[model samples]
Target: MFRTRSDKVSLVMGHVIVTRGIAELPAVFFTAIMEAVRRFDDFTEHNDPHGEHDFGALTVSGERIFWKIDYYKRGTEEGSPDPSNMVLTERVLTVMLAEEY
Candidate 1:
């Protein structure tokens, strides 16, 4: 029913992880980054060739930021064999400052 695998990724969006670098940002800048991530929809062939919409980069308050969604076997560290199956996958979205990458 979803248009893409990304549409099915909502189940994992709740599991956000901000890296240490991002955690140290000022509250205003941090909030901006989070809001940007929520509103992001600039996918293109160059930035999202796979069309998974699992990764993105943006700038907030002049600071570069990067975010990525990774799929893993639910409750395990291994990569998921089928990322489309939400029941079998645990998606972790990690947000970090570009310099931290």
Candidate 2:
């Protein structure tokens, strides 16, 4: 929702965070990684056993990367009591290199 639809994301207080390793990549590679993440849809039983579409792995420019979305309480560092309740939840999407896992 974050990559393709900003208006919807704003309703849930969505945020995107890139790790240090990913931030240091060249502009081309960084752009490629973001694009790859936006297009990622390779979920399977092995990687998505829980059926929560909040995590994914992909490769860009020969480098493996992972992205995950976590729910938190707005204006606090605690996890949200009800992620489904957009009124009280904030979504934080983190992107990082595989090695950083």
Candidate 3:
């Protein structure tokens, strides 16, 4: 399947939720996420080159943040499903606090 780009990310929080598009991703924040991903990939159990990202949690800027990507195994219908395609679609990243769902 062809890889799809993350056009934006949805943020889910305990009290409130928000969103941040790819264009709005702060460079510093993006850097932090990349660092974490790199570290995760280096771990013995996550060494698979074709591994797909599922969940991630880390502290950046003194804030504990968690993230998960929803892959659209099937295309979006009625604006539901975070990531909406057949087999693979745009992956929507859901970011939130550690305590939030």
Candidate 4:
């Protein structure tokens, strides 16, 4: 699968990894993710281990998928604070294919 970005937020947009299996590479799965993000209008932001803004989704092969939506406020040391920023909500959708024998 490929990655997509909708906004220019460098640290809070388009951060998804592909994994799980081949079946998860379909367009439907990606679309579902988009839908989920749309449903929510806000998100919470946090500093990751690296101290950088962490936002986006990640998937692992033969394991599971994860989504991270973040929301927070930032401003200059003297300037007024900006409005709340919302990151996209991320998650994994399990699409079952035919069972193998």
Query: Which model scores highest in lDDT?
Result: 2
Kindly give the number of clashing pairs for every candidate: 0, 0, 1, 7
lDDT of 4 by residue, 11-101 (tens): 3232233334434566776566445433432333542444332243333333233444332232222322332223223222233221310
The superposed Cα distance between candidate 4 and the true structure at residue 66, in angstroms, equals: 1.4
TM-score of each: 0.87, 0.86, 0.41, 0.24
Q: What global local distance difference test value does model 1 have?
A: 0.82
lDDT of 3: 0.47
What C-alpha lDDT do the candidate models reach, one value each? Answer: 0.82, 0.85, 0.47, 0.35
Those runs of model 3 whose alpha carbons end farther than 4 Å from true positions after fitting are 1-50, 77-88
Task: Give the alpha carbon lDDT tens digit for every residue of 1-101 in model 3.
Answer: 12233435433311112244322458887667545543442223453334454566676666566666555434452333434333344445566655565
Model 2, global lDDT: 0.85
Please give, for residues 1-101, the per-residue lDDT of candidate 1 as tens digits.
11244544433333789999899888988898989987788899999998888899998889899999888898999999998787898778899999999
Q: How do the candidates rank by TM-score, highest first?
A: 1, 2, 3, 4
lDDT of 2 by residue, 1-101 (tens): 45333324333348899999999999999999989987777889999998777899998889999999988998899999997777898889999999999
Q: Which segments of model 2 are wrong by more than 4 Å?
A: 1-13
Which sequence of candidate numbers ranks them by lDDT, best first? 2, 1, 3, 4
User: Alpha-carbon error at 28 in model 3, in Å?
Assistant: 8.8
The deviation in Å at residue 89 for candidate 1 is 0.5
| Residue 27 lDDT in candidate 1 | 94
**Clashing residue pairs, backbone N/CA/C < 3 A, model 4:** 20-60, 20-61, 43-71, 44-70, 44-71, 45-71, 67-90
Candidate 3, residue 67: lDDT = 64
